[model samples]
Target: MTRACATLTLFLGLPQGTMGFASSFSACRSQASAAPRTALLRAWGRTSSGSSSERQPLRHLRRRRSEGLVASLSTKGEREGNPATEEEAQLLQHLSSPPKSQRRHQQQPQQPRTSTKRGTTRKRLTSTGGLKSLPIVTPSIELLSHASRRSKKVSQDMLIKNARNRSRKWVAERMDMLGKATSKPLRDIIRQYKHQLPILHPFEATLADLTVRAREKTGERTLQSVLDDVNDFRKVALEISKSAAREGKLGEKKSEIMQTMDAGYSRMEDHFLTNGSVLEDLTEIQKSLRSLPIVQLHLPTVVLVGAPNVGKSSIVRAVSTGTPEVNSYPFTTRGMALGHMFHPETNARYQIMDTPGVLSRPDGERNEMEALTLASMQHLPTAVIFVMDLSGHSGHLSSLDNQMQVRHELRRRFPRRPWLDVVSKADLPRLELEKAKEALPEGYLDLSTLDGTGVEELKTRLFEMYEIIERILAPPPEVQR
Candidate 1:
């Protein structure tokens, strides 16, 4: 029996005298029948021969020994009301759990997948996606001749003029030079305009459209038509240059090469002469666009608007960093002016814009100044401060009724916008008409920029409006988290 236990321990891969080995062997001897014991001993004796064919009998013996040990443990547990011993429980746990390599794989962090394609980088979007600034557009004639000037400079090189096979080389060179010169500049200008048009803020786009319309000639051409014409001329010029150069290359004639180059130059000149007015108009439009006030859309803005000479500029000058021209006459603020104010405690910045006076008239009848004011109120994300002068002391171009009509019309057009009303030039005596008094909205703020009355309150209210706008524009909590 001692030899049998020793042999069993060696086959089971457990150390001698270990608690598990001792427990398992003793359990197997006590619980196993005589027939199984004899069979296991016979198998062990065969394994001692060290024959490869005898290894199966040894494995069978070890499996039977394990079964006997488990049966003994289970029967004893039944009597004791427990199903397994500590050693048996540990054996089962080791069998049930995953392998060490698999557990390690599960514990490791995953990495983000990388893309291998070119130019697939992500771009960040701005809060307002508006143009930050306008690109400088070169003057019409200068821009048209820029490529020619560059080509001329390149042609002036002595080595280029005196190279071997000069006529053939010059014809090919001139083909490339003239083709690129005639087309590239025009293409660049077209690309610039195309790129800028799509990203323009709505207000600026409206102004641009109005400017183009004002300069448009009847039954002649628009800016876009002129651009199309330039493109067509570019194509024609390229075709002419390539055709002439190909003919010149077949047989090198200096006179014919010069004539081919002259043809290309003449095509370019014809394009410029035909589209000169439209080109000048485009240049002027670019200048106008650049002159426009740069409004930061992310900042909470308050736009001051009303009829001519109602002291909108005065309010802007009093409450904000803007110093718009204050005058006794109408249309003092012919253009948009942007200014800023900062909260004393939070240091949050707010924008204030002074726009030109809008007249109470149909859209088609409105002048450029009126159109500009209307554009501001229509498109900007802003609070409107409609300034009214009840004293009849303004340039008198706009009566009290006209001012009220302008306010009502604007409010009707842009309902649900943050709005306020102000009676400017408060020190002067007001109109005695009861109708004007009744027409005035309740809680309208009255202030005199001359003596600073109610300016502090206006600033306070503007800051409060900014806070409300900030909450409205804030990102959701989940996104912020």
Candidate 2:
């Protein structure tokens, strides 16, 4: 019996959890059959459960410092071999309780020494310019119970088979965020992620597949196009590998793992840089084919035009998150900024640019409006959003970067294009956007982003206008340049 127990302990490769199970079983506290318990131990990947003469070699590595993650949920930091600090012992005790989000935000400080968690709250957090905070919130034990209930509401798989996966109940309460990433087909996503899985064999790049796609998508291949994708793929692989290494969670096979990544990256890098001249022309042709449709979608862009200190940036911040710095003062946004936020449910995506403040007299500066207008034009926005300040402070609308100059430039550079107007700042009492709307005889949408009023209805109106431009301006496949 002693020899059998000793053999069973030797095969359990687990460092901490197995040792406790071994000691407990050997003590014979419960009356479960020995054969079933021994079989269970073997199923946990033990090679041999009963080799009496052989003694397993013990790990000689020193006890490492604990990673102070959600500390309250940690296990006993150290056993006889695992010596841990006093703080670690307290952390493990806290982990045994409910996680963050379970505890109220105010009570989270009393949690563990680290006291961190990701909670759900839609309150407007104070943000520094060009920055946002990432706060940790705690969760409750009732999470599992909530998930189980929701699973029943969703589907049989979600309710029954995926009971464990559905345990995250708090996620369903918020708006569906997964919809964006799920835009691609399930098969395409599976294929993309599948390529990332560690492969024992070399993954070869196919020239034929590219040829097929070139013919199918655009009926020709340009050299610049293929080279661009090749360069992009190389950059992507290197970034992915470096990020994985930086995470420091590779565990036992880290050296072997990094070596595999380095080898894979080198294989592709040598192929591209070493054999460049022969492939250059074909790549360009491929890119040209892809460019055809994109060129058609791009019309002369209409940038959100405004002066410093006049809620120009605020309208940008409110309407579309183009990252124009919003403040009570003037000239907060420095460089021309660009960002895109699509509607949650619809396929509507607005190409928005939050440009540097457009002053009447150049602040000894290059015409910021002209520069911003040119910068946005490269994107080929179907329509323009001339976001203006409506709060009784739109300084000399016709004189400042004036409407006529803007219209003349667009007509001269990109003729037969569409441009729209957006008059902002409806929240302030004295400001009347209706008067501001008259500044642009082309017409405008009256909106107040601060109050969240007129936002949705205005967006709906913008999309309707976008559809009209799409039909009128979208060029066919034959027009190359």
Candidate 3:
């Protein structure tokens, strides 16, 4: 009876169904084995009452006995039997929690994280708990791979979108910059200049707007956009130049106008050189820097050829800034003189040479003035500028025979050269002007140089005349616009 009470007291200390195993394990030595078996059968409700699924709780213990998965319980049960068995039996009750490592990690000797990822082999437990190396999930690599794929996909999408946006912006800017009117063709000689100008039309217009108007109404802020667009204007100009030059029509005003710029001369030079076109003609135009003394070949050079004291030097001094040897005598100018005049609009310049005096007399060497003027044109055979005095009626003129001789010599020597005519001293009486006009060549200009009366007008007319003469003398092979 005292033994039964002791066994009952121990049974009270254990968990529910575990009390059956506890009693059986302890009571075999302490009391009745049959009593423990009866208690186990009662705790189970009945020995036959447990279902197959309900009987599954003991399956782990049965399986663990074979696999030795319960080492902690096995060792502890052999040493301090009852309670250790009870604790292990309770441990097997739930799967959510795992047993602590039996080796106690040796406190790991405070191992650094540098320990190998491969775990130390587990030891059989000497205590009531054990650890199994669970599958080590590499959270970092999985996460990194996923994130990398997602980020790469996102980056690719962004790059494509950005490129599309830039293309759209570029198209918008290009269209806006090259408005409508400037894109049209230029027509007429007195009208628009048809040549593609050196300055890019867009940029040139923008710069021009910036200077004249304090603010641009185009609604753009960055100068970079403006500059970017203007660069192409020079390209258009180069195209025109190349086309014109290829056809040998580069000198025609309507054709050459395509290569000029309203911006300035330097701008044209920049646009021309940007595309690497050879500027041989420009070198000839700005010939001041030329090392060799240049001669204009077979060019019509009309000199101020007249008798001294008839105001021949006056005409040279009046039209250009030439300071001739002026005196109130017949033999004042001992030698020939040279001067030049320039006009911007038609792009004309004249090299006027003043002479002594000319006469109708048929001497072998001729008059001092007539001799020098004719001699220069006779050899080079351009044109002659006769500065005849138109102040008196029935003027002392070069005879038809003498005129015929000069024309014959020029036609024989330089057949392709051009000639220009001039009737000087227009401020004279109208009667003398009309009489002088009858005595001169077909397309003659009357000039009074002192007052700049016909100076600029004459320059435009002369330059226009030069164009006609230039076209007639040197027709272009190409029909470039």
Model 1 poorest ten-residue lDDT run: 52-61
* Clash number for candidate 1: 0
Local error of candidate 1 at residue 361 (angstroms): 2.8
Each prediction's TM-score versus the true structure: 0.61, 0.30, 0.29
- In model 3, what is the error at residue 479, expressed in angstroms? 17
Residues 336-446, candidate 1: write the lDDT tens digits.
Answer: 656688889988888888878878888668776776666555445567888998888776667888898999888876555578899888888887446678899998998
Taking all chains together, the TM-score of candidate 3 against the true structure is 0.29
lDDT of each: 0.53, 0.33, 0.32
Q: Please provide, for model 2 over 1-481, each residue's C-alpha lDDT reduced to its tens digit, 9 standing for 90 to 100.
A: 2222211112111111111110111110112111232332232222222321222222223322232111212135412332112222232333233444553332322211111234322211111110111111111112112322332233223553433233222122110211111112222422331221111000000111222332433333322232233334333333433443332233234343334323322332232233322233332332322222111123222346554445545555555645533211111125444434455566555554555544443323434233433333322333455555545565665333354455444444333334565656666654453453444556556677777877887666656655544443333222122
Q: Once all C-alphas are superposed, what RMSD does model 2 give against the true structure?
A: 31.1
Give the higher-lDDT candidate: 1 or 2: 1
The digit string of per-residue lDDT tens for model 3 on 1-481 reads: 2222222222112211111111111000011011232332233222322221211111111111222111121222223323322422322222122235432332221111111114332222111101111111122122222322332221212343555443333322222222221122111210111111111111121112222122112232222221122224323433433332332322234222322211111222233233211112111111211121123432323455544455656666665644643322111235555556564654355455565555544444453335434434432213345444555542335433343344444334333334454555566665444444455567666677655566666555545544533332232232223
Q: Which one wins by TM-score: 2 or 3?
A: 2
Give the runs in model 2 whose Cα sits over 4 Å from its true position.
1-302, 321-333, 343-348, 359-365, 378-382, 390-415, 429-442, 468-481
Query: Model 1: C-alpha RMSD to truth?
Result: 38.0
**Candidate scoring better on lDDT of 2 and 3:** 2
lDDT of 3 at 59: 10
Worst 10 residues of 3 by lDDT: 20-29
